[model samples]
Target: MTRSDDESRRVYATQGLIDLLLERAAAADPARENVVLDATPAGEFDADLGVDPATPVLTHFYLPAGRAVSDVFGVDLGTPAGRGRARFLTHPQGPAELTRRDDLAGVVLLAVPPWGTETLTAFDRQGRRLPLTVLDAEPPVESLPE
Candidate 1:
């Protein structure tokens, strides 16, 4: 598929993921807090991430990482979708980026705590989990691709 086609798919997947998690949160406990991650430009990710900027990156990583990350909202409910909806747009399993990149300690994404502790647990393809910081919204960036 073309780059634009791929981007469109990723955007859909990211939005769908947010909607699903929020919906689930409203169901399990409407009063409960939920997280909404912001999918920003690839260039913005370069600054926040410790990984080598040379590695080709996508606008969204966590979502396309795999189903394992899809269910990040499952943290409180104890149920992960096991496959991220964006999995089709990117990698088959594990993180969208290389599992072990010298510049990266792990994947990085903008955390959005629409309501929550501002912290969430996400797992990689190997089932290895890590605590990712969830922000109130995505950080500002200078250049964004159209």
Candidate 2:
């Protein structure tokens, strides 16, 4: 298969997994409908993440609560300027607008680049950052031929 084909399949599978998780969450708690996660991009998908001053770093992370991700990014603990460059991902659909019976789960595009990300954080409805549990992916031993 072509590289584009592989990428398309990857995107489809990732979205399917997210849908399954949302379904399961809804089944467990009927009141969890229309759950707005803080891991969504607050504005345009192509918004500059400000990771680098010379170049724009764009990333949209839609991390599910209590789930392990395949990608990992380290926080810039050595640089004090990193804290000022932090960008938060918040759901576009405000929580106050959602009703108890709205089962519409927010659609998240998970096609994110792993580079230029200094820090990652998720927040609750009360604006408290929740601890994230990440599962780092093993590095590939070889690269695919172009």
Candidate 3:
């Protein structure tokens, strides 16, 4: 197969695995149901990119309840509840800034650490804490040189 075709297969497999894991985790905790799962520090990267690694840009995927947040809001991306809370500013441009994919099954929120610091906590609409099974933020080991 061509390299592109092989890569496509790998991507699909990886997504399948992520979906399966999320399903199981959500099943165990009703609070986690239909919520975004945040992976921050575990997802930090070098500052070589345009963004500051210390002010990590964390993202989570969730099905939108009624479009976007009305205004800037604070949220916990960490587990055990209150340990992590950060404020997020809604982009004036809206979701289109993130993805042009009309076929997307859910919305993706891009959140940056507060004051160049990291925190982890997640909450449902009712402001109740939700459990999260964070995935590694780094690239796959296979992508690295031996």
Per model, how many backbone clashes are there? 8, 0, 7
Question: Model 1: how far is 20 from its true place, Å?
Answer: 8.3
**Quick one: RMSD of model 2?**
16.5
lDDT of 2 by residue, 3-122 (tens): 554332221112332344434443544223222222222122243432222321112222333213213334322323322222222222334232333322222221111211122233
What is the C-alpha local distance difference test score of each model? 0.32, 0.28, 0.30
lDDT of 1 by residue, 1-146 (tens): 67554433222113334344544444544232223233444334424443233322322323223345547743423223442222211122223332442122223222223422232234333434333333223333456689
Give the lDDT of residue 46 in candidate 3. 28
How would the candidate models be sorted by TM-score, starting from the highest?
A: 1, 3, 2
Q: What is the TM-score of each candidate against the true structure?
A: 0.26, 0.19, 0.22
Best by lDDT: 1
**Candidate 3's residue-wise lDDT over 90-125, tens digit each?**
222233122332121122222222211122233333
Which structure among the candidates has the greatest TM-score?
1
Which is better, 2 or 3, measured by TM-score? 3
